[model samples]
Target: MIQFKNLTLRRGVKELILNATLTLNPGSKAGLTGANGAGKSSLFALLMGQLHADQGEALLPPHWVVAHVAQETPALAVSAIDYVLDGDRELRELEARLAEAERDNDGVAIGHLHAELARIDAWSARSRAARLLSGLGFANDAIEREVASFSGGWRMRLNLAQALMCRSDLLLLDEPTNHLDLETVLWLEDWLKGYPGTLLMISHDRDFLDSVCSHIVELANQTLTLYTGNYSQFETLRAEKLARQQGDFERQQRQIAHLESFITRFKAKATKARQAQSRIKALEKLERIAPAHVHSPFDFHFETPESLPNPLLRLDAISAGYGGKPVLDNLSLSIESGSRIGLLGVNGAGKSTLVKLLAGELAPLRGERIEAQMLKVGYFSQHQLETLREDDTPLGHMQRLAPDAREQVLRTFLGGFNFHGDAALGPVGPMSGGEKARLALALIVWTRPNLLLLDEPTNHLDLEMRHALTLALQDFAGALLVVSHDRSLLEATTDTFWLVGDGAAKPFDGDLEDYRQWRLARQAEALRPSSDDTAAPNRKEQKRQEAELRQRMSQQKKPLLARLAKLEKSIELLTTEKAGLEAFMASEEAYADDNRARLADSAKRQGEASAELERLEEEWLALQEEIEALENGYPQQ
Candidate 1:
């Protein structure tokens, strides 16, 4: 368990947490969330002992091992698997001692170290490291590559894999999904859901938090508030709480009304794909959750395009890639004014290459790209963040775009992205990633382009900023093509999906869920055994063997299936009861003096139920993995 007792944390003159107390029990998965500069990372520092509290104390069990992803990864010559194995300090230490014992010819010491290694299951450490790397999107051969050979993002994935490799009781992750693709993000979710340790992660991805976190701790106004359930539940509860406050009520109502208006209007708009309907539903849900973010600093929308050109951009028989190699070949696609497309693929599968082609940043290796006479493209990518002049500020950048526009107009436009006062005037050199990203977005929106090509735009943005961006994109009457691991953003803004893989880019006739299923099936097929005998097997013998294997597997899974059913039922009952308790707690009546005792009881019961539910969920996940292994013909450990 981790505890903060009357903790007052300060970084220089600024106070982050003021007399905040929080207790996160063992094995509880918590999501740390707040605005960009809201001390979420500072709180993590407090737990990791990297920073001391200004007053009181932050405590963790003395024996518990803590692991966190490194902010920087040096260019190491060691193989990726070795770097990951180094995360297990105990294993590394024992192996060192064993080598020393061997050199000294000490049989007893060598035997003892081997026993300890077995106790820690160190023999399988490499395999475990490989699994982590695989889930993080490393190819099998890449796992054996030298760490120094990988790019920055791939190196970050190595850092993550190393952190996960550590057999720690407490794990702290900050923006774990930053460099991940959607498939990798989904894989990470499953891995985290099954993690047996206490996880405190900071992520802006709402869907990721909902899938992986059992609790959410929000830092706001120098206060820490712990909420039961996931991000969605926290948002709902917070919305209800804010709605009752006189100061916030008016603002909340206005935001809700604005979202409702958008939804009502957009519902009547014809869309080219079923995902458009999904986006509409997502927006409606966003309207319900709007109050939770009423206090967000960001408030901006794309300006209406001067012209709505049909087929804003077109690619014909394109072959796009770097150098002489074609990553995507023979691809033809058209982006119209109403095209709202989400790009889906594994990392390095030509999604970005396609975006580069559409953005006119990369010329097609072989083919033609046609653009409308009125085509105006607003392109954003992580690389663009680097292009910002360090000596210049947001105002200066905007001035470069519209030299004739008045400074006040530029300043006012920048304010919509929450770059105000000194933030707008200061050099971009000292700005945080989120601030720089906001500035980049402000610059793009000022162009009033009819086409937007955003690649992982939400990488450094917080939840509020992400929500604001989603809202703005929803209202933008232009074509949008986005590549992001943030499922919420993809679901809310895109009406179609294009799968970029197999050396080509093409329309994927399905939603994200379907893609997920397709990915799973693909993985299963890859894992299934393949024989190179070339000769066709006898059909009758193959059928008999398959039947026998199925019978055996069915018998083995029967008990596990029964247990899974029972666990599901138990989880359902507990969840319903917990919801009832939370509903009471959210009610104004729960705060009354007369109902204080009842409130306390309900709170206690809710905590217990949450813990129990977490336990059941973990077990259920383990069983699921076991079942999947069986179905895939892999032996469970």
Candidate 2:
């Protein structure tokens, strides 16, 4: 069990949780949610022992084993399964002792270690790791690949897998589904439901929360409120509470106003001075009830497109992919005006490729792509955030897009995206990812395109931003084609779904649940043994083949291992620097009014360092995979 008794947590000058008390019983699965910058991450930090509460007790059982996904994963050359298996610390420690005992020929110690291993079921650990990886969308071959041989997103999945592999009493997952595809999200939901440990996760995916959370813990207004039941239930209960709070607030205001009036008029009279003083004392003692605030800070709507042309874009038997290789082949699809479609696929299944092809960013290798006259396409992707000028402000970006628009007009428009006044004027370099995403969205909405091609548009968005976008999309008159893992957004905004798999894109006949079933069936089919295999390969022959393959792979491993060493050093340095920056930002002096410039500089440097670290890790992965391919006598990609 975990307990926060009158916990007061602060970051710099901002008080996040003030005198908040909550108890999470053992085996409780809760969803922690709040608006962006509402201290959800800070709370996780507190629970993980990375941060101490400013004033009060945050207690967990002394013997409880807590597990959390590491924020950074170095480009390690270890096989993915080994990395995941490392999560079982007890198992690893026991194995180490067993190896030492065997070296020393200590039969007693060896027997004890083997008995302990049996107790923990360590013999099946590898298979367990493989299954965890598979559930997170890793292929069987990928499970044997080096950890360095995966891109950032795949590495995130690996981190998640490692966290899940831990045999612990508590698990803390922050935005666990952010890097996942819809199929993987479904798999994770099912997995979490069966988890026996206490789980606290932070996520903007409402459907994921509703599916897995037994209780909802909301962080708002410097307080922690625990509501029984799922997120939908939390919303209903919160709304009703807010309604009552509003009524109470209004009544309190009237009573206070009357008290003030009585004190003001009668205080000047000599005979009534005693009564006036008594009233003043009463007023001073009155507890103030804060007003109920239900409105989301975000408010915006998509404007009508400049032109509405039927069949805005059409792909005729097109083959789309990178470097002339087709991930989606002979796919004929069309986007008509007012059509709302969601793209569903596993990671690397060409959802983004299809979006790029539709947005005119990719050239079809085999077929014709046709566009209606006066077609205006607005495309939004994670890449759009990178395209933003680091030195330019949000207002500056909008001004360049609409040079004729007035400055005040542009400022007002950006405000709708919550980039108000000084925030809109600040350089984009120091802004958070979610803020950058909002800016990109604002620019897209400003264009009033007849067709929208959004690829994972909700990636860095918070719940409020997601809700706002959902509402805007619902009211959008233009055709929309979206590739997102957010089931709530898909359910609210899209009328149809297209499943992208098996080198083809076709209309999915059912909703998200049906897509989940389709994915499970596909996975089952892939795992099923072939009927053509009449007999198993001879064990000696299989061993000989594996020996030969390993011998060849060992010859090519040296250079990749050297490069990995260098990458590890670079990653460590960058990680340390980033941590120092974070430490400074968390300090009280960093938030001082006079230290604003230094704070901004630290933030910008932190962002640059993180981006560079990601690039280096990605390059490391590519090089490692290339080495693997060469050893196997094949070309990567």
Candidate 3:
């Protein structure tokens, strides 16, 4: 557990956190959410003791261990397992002591060593380490791989796994989900949900927070405010609070205006002079609430040329790979103009390779790849920041991208993406992921290309910026080919889905939810217990025989079907109830009835029904898919 009391952190003249008081309870999962530069990461640093506050103090649990995983991982020349094993310093020391005791052959020392070994063994340290490593997406073989050979993303995962392996009293994670793939992220969500220790994480991942955190803490205006709910609930409550504050400020202004009017009108009157002066004094002494600073909205628009009649890109039986290991084999697909396509697949499923082929960065290993004539492509790769010159300022980068453009024009463009004033002159190398992504986007937009290829464009963007970018892409009249695993982003911005699987590309209608269901069904089929036997069956299975196996399987099918039916019924009932509530809540008369009590009740019921319906639907769909796969044989789509 950790607590902050009147903590004020400053970086030179700029105050980062002001008078912040917060507490992280034991076994509590807390998420810190705020706009960029709002001190979320700074608070994390303060909690980790990496940065000291200029004023006040942080009260921490006595001798409590804390493990921190920073956004950027340090480079190390070591094996991944060795790095993770380092997390258990006590266990390592115990092993060393035990070795010494065995060498000395002292009874007392051996007894102590045996006890220590037993304690370490009781903890199941090896299993815990393996679980943490696998949960963070390190394949069993990759655990022994040298850290230096891995990419930056994999290294970040290694660092995260190491932190998780520590199993400290408190975990401080900053943007922990940034480098994680969908599977690893899901694993982390489950792990954190059941995590017994205190967790204080700064994440822009809305879904992750909603799944794991019990409380949302926001850092804004140099202060921290705790909300007893997830990020979405916090957003709603914060908006309401701001509205109430605005209303109170307005009421005070009205009262002040009345007092000033009375003072101005009665200033020279002999009978009322004292009262007027008293009102003036009171008015002057009143403490005014500063209005909230509003962020300037960036109106982004991507212009696209006329749509091509045929597909802009076509892959004819193409195969791509690295070092002769096939990533894609005999893949064929066509991307049409004005199509908003989302590429969905598991990690290392050739999605990135496909993007490269579309971008013309890689040639097809076997077969033809073609692009339409006059097709101007603008791409934002996952590692697009690498393309930027570290020595150049933002303005300089933009200038290099558009050399013919005026300096004033370049500055204006950079400012639109929140890089203004001195920020535009800052070196690009130190910029955050969000800033770099925005800069890359700004450059892409300046080119005014009709074909856009985006690979995880929402990687580091905050929710607001993600929404803004989604809206911008929605309005753009161009062909979009995006590869991202963010469901919300894909659902909001994509109209078509391209599923890369089994060495081929398949197209699907609808959004990510549909694809998710399809993928889950496929996985269920793949994982379904099979009767294949390379050797003799075990005694337990042989005793059951084929008849008993069929009977058990049949019995299992019945409950699954019944559960599916119940879920369907629940979904239907909730749908009707939600609709009725929405109809009543939308009526103006409902608000006038008994102080809007009926409307309030209807709104609450609607929310509950909607949430329940979503849960039931997800379960129902998963069950139905599983049952269908069990009933029918597995067939490749």
User: Regarding lDDT, does 1 or 3 come out ahead?
Assistant: 1
lDDT of 3 by residue, 1-637 (tens): 5778898876433577888888767887889887887777667766666566677888888878888874334346877887877776677788788788788887899898778778767358777877788667566556766765454456667778778877588888887877455656767888888877888898877777888888888888888888988878887888888888888888888989999999989999999999999999999899986554445445566766654545788889999865344568998888888888888776666677788889988777798988888788889874566677767888998877889989998888777787889999977755666777788898898888888899878877887777678788888787888876566667777788877767777887756556656755865686487776732456445445633544545665778656755665676777788767756654556657584777767767765675566545444534644553333211101
Alpha carbon lDDT of each predicted model:
0.82, 0.85, 0.73
User: Which 10-residue window in model 2 sums to the lowest lDDT?
Assistant: 628-637
Clash number by candidate, in order: 0, 0, 0
Q: Rank the candidates by lDDT, best first.
A: 2, 1, 3
| Residue-level lDDT tens digits of model 1 in 1-637 | 8888998986534688899988999999999988767898878877777566778889988999999998556668999999999999899999999999999999999999999999999989989998888788776656777876554456678888899999999999998998678999999999999999999999999999999888999898788999999999999987877766645656656766765666666666666335546656665676332223457788899989999989898899988764355678888878988899999987777777788889999888899999999999999987677778878988889999999999998888888899888788888765666787888898899999999999989977888899999999999998999999999999999999999888777789989999999999999897787785642466456557656765676677778777866876887888799878766765668768999889888878876786667556545544654454344321111
Model 1 — which ten-residue stretch has the worst lDDT?
628-637
Which candidate gets the maximum TM-score versus the true structure? 2
lDDT for 304 in candidate 3 is 60
**Higher-scoring candidate on TM-score, 1 or 2:** 2
Model 2 bad stretches (over 4 Å):
533-574, 578-637
Number of the candidate with higher TM-score, 2 or 3: 2
Q: Model 2 clash tally?
A: 0
